[model samples]
Target: MTEPKAIVSDLESFVAIAKQVIADTRDKKAIPGKLKPYLEQLIRHREWLDERFRQPNPDAFAVYTLHQEPDDSLLIMSAVFLPGQGTPVHDHAVWGLYGVMENQTEDTRYERIDDRSRPDYAELRVVDRRLVRQGEVMISYPPDQDIHRVVNTSDKPTLEIHVYGADLSKLRRRVYDPQTGRVKVIQARVPVN
Candidate 1:
């Protein structure tokens, strides 16, 4: 077996860089596209990220808030998903970049087929299902194309970092039922201190 890669020694510095990137592009129209490079930089330090945030829970997955702006312009978080753990099909309603830090995650992207204006009803169709591996990034934005579910496909814990255009924890987003076309408002779960 080969030796493990070295962990990132300065998570704070990385956070600072991420903050700067977000701050610089907060007013931009294409938030997700503009933040991709910066987010990719973080992915380059995945070994360090995984070392700092990979804590798998037995009952559920763990989400860690690495950084958040005072004005809610940006929120950076790390999430750990254990094998077989996943999220309900949900929408962020904000532009964001999700980068894999460790192992692999299977993301099933969807498209709403009916009028999303009706909160209680929604029709969705699967657009794509792909495995996002370590060092890879996924972009979400425009609300319409952001509905999806993420699942951990590996036996080991999977770690991922997300950079959002707003404080996702404070947003009341929508979770959809693909089978029944039902929709419900759900608050995004933020990490505890």
Candidate 2:
């Protein structure tokens, strides 16, 4: 396991680095893709993540905010998913990166195949499905490549690092039900802490 001190240092260092990258870029939406390599570097070596952010919720997947800018410019969170737990198909309205920090996870990307002219309705097709092992990353930018569902198919628990351009809890996101062609816009899930 990685040393605790170093882990904290790395996290702080990453926040600073991410801020700089965002400031230097003209197109803020490109931040996630630009920071992908840096994020991979942070989680490459699987180690004991902070206990505070690893606590599980028996009823639902858990999310804990590790860092957030006062201006709501950046939000960093840790998510824990128990075996067979996952999220409803949804989209983040902002650009961000999600990295697998512990065990593997199944990420299924969906593409809206319908014209979207119908109100409160949407038809989606699976565009990609893969087992994202530890250290792998997922990226999203609004209105394009922004939809996915993540599940912990493995028997053990899974931990993921999520960094978003906005305070996700404040943004309203769209959730899709492919079977019913239903679409609902709702607030993002609030973090436990």
Clashes of 1: 1
lDDT over C-alpha atoms for residue 118 of model 2 = 88
Tell me how candidate 1 scores on lDDT: 0.75
**lDDT (tens digit, per residue) of candidate 2 on 31-117:** 888777777777764453578889989999999988899988889888999999898888888888989988999999998888979
The TM-score, computed over Cα atoms with residue i paired to residue i, of candidate 1 is 0.83
lDDT tens digits, residue span 105-144, model 1: 9999999888658879998899999999888889888656
TM-score for each of the candidates: 0.83, 0.89
Which ranges of candidate 2 are over 4 A from the true structure? 1-9, 45-49, 190-193
Predicted structure 2: clash tally: 0
Query: Model 1: which ten-residue window has the lowest total lDDT?
Result: 1-10
- Model 1 residue 105 CA deviation (Å) reads 0.5
